[model samples]
Target: MDKSVSKSSQPSGGNGFPTSSSNGRKLNKKLVYLCSIVMAVLFFLGIAAFVFLFLLHKNPKATNKNIASFRVDSIFVSRFKLSSSKITASWDIRLSVQNPSTASVSYQTFYTWIQYKQERLSNVTNIAPFQVRGNNWTAENGKLVAKSVRADEKVIEDMATEMANGSVNFNIGLYAGFWIGNEEAKRVWRAVEAHCSDLKIGFSSKDNMGKLIGEPIECILTKTW
Candidate 1:
């Protein structure tokens, strides 16, 4: 009798393709992960861009507009009642101003050797730049303060100590107003006005150097308690 033959079944290997489908599936999974990572990055970038654009559109200050303004909120002249202190006028003043535009505004503020009742006082120099706009204090409309006299015993101080303590005994008015422009003549006027001996006089801005007022503007100065 002839011997019977048997064969075992097994995967083919000579073509180098029996495990290719599994390898291809692994590759697809890696690609999916890579795509997911790329999508995440793009999503974050898109969100950041959207936020930036939203702020730019919703806020005018963030937009393009560069015209600032300022004001003399309050003024305090110490010793008005007692008139003590032979500098018969050692004083501290308070002024509030604003920047209503987009860019920063700058100007020099010189102490006007006040020639009031025939007395030569000390001169003060203030070459400081005021920048409280869209970058800071935007909600309050770019408002800032100068607490020290341009030419006083103190360069600048958070004044009104007497007023805060109900100890001030003087009465006087310190009025002020000005405008900054994008012109040479206006720049000249900034210097001229800063050196003028009349900031304590009146707020008649209509009679200034020119009929043009640009960057900064203030309301009529008034005396207040």
Candidate 2:
């Protein structure tokens, strides 16, 4: 006799549509493959970030260009006399301030001091507000004077001895704030401090006028914030 197939005699997943268990297997495989792809992408991105940071660290000059430079061009002492109990002097200072960065810099009021044998002297003038463009420089002038000011006995003696030797050493300190900006707008101000040390001013007995000796003194720049 001719046999007939029943619905229950066929395979459980023999229909055009897969069974529930077969669908579950395919879905799990797709989820696993998606997760692997995501992980691979993340790993490559992390490697790229690491390489970029390493390159930046290796090349620091790219960021150092924002800083400026300062130098003491000349210092003239028109009069300087040290007595047993007092001191008297007149100093004219010239500074060359250069903006080596790509941005323009606007300076605030500058505070400058002169020191002899570590003793600060009285000053009359300060550097006024100014601005400089990229790769530009400016000459700043200041005056310091001491008119029969009382001095320490030790300092007076030391200064007198040094002056007789034809040269005297002094230190120059500068403190100020500056704003850095592009063409669009300006940013906040940053404080800076500079120190130019071991400045030698040589004097002649004939004229008694002292002038800076040797090469131009470069100031040590420090950023306060």
| Candidate 1 lDDT, 12-124, residue by residue in tens | 44344567777789999999999999999999999999999888755434433323333433333332211122233333333344455343344334222232323333333
For model 1, what is the error of residue 165's alpha carbon versus the real structure, in angstroms, after optimal superposition? 65
Candidate 2 deviant stretches above 4 angstroms: 1-66, 182-185
Colliding residue pairs in candidate 2: none
| TM-score of decoy 2 | 0.69
Summarize candidate 2's per-residue lDDT along 1-225 as a digit string, tens digits.
Answer: 224356566557776567899889999999999999999999999999999888766532235434667899999987777778887888889998887755678887678878876777666356889998867999888887878878789988887788889998998888877777754353556677888999999999887689999999999976555
Please, what is the whole-model Cα lDDT of each candidate in the order they appear? 0.35, 0.79
Q: Lowest-lDDT window of 10 residues in candidate 2?
A: 57-66
Query: What lDDT is reached at residue 174 by model 2?
Result: 84
What lDDT score is found at residue 108 in candidate 1? 35
Against the true structure, whose TM-score is highest?
2
Model 1 segments more than 4 A misplaced: 1-9, 14-18, 60-225
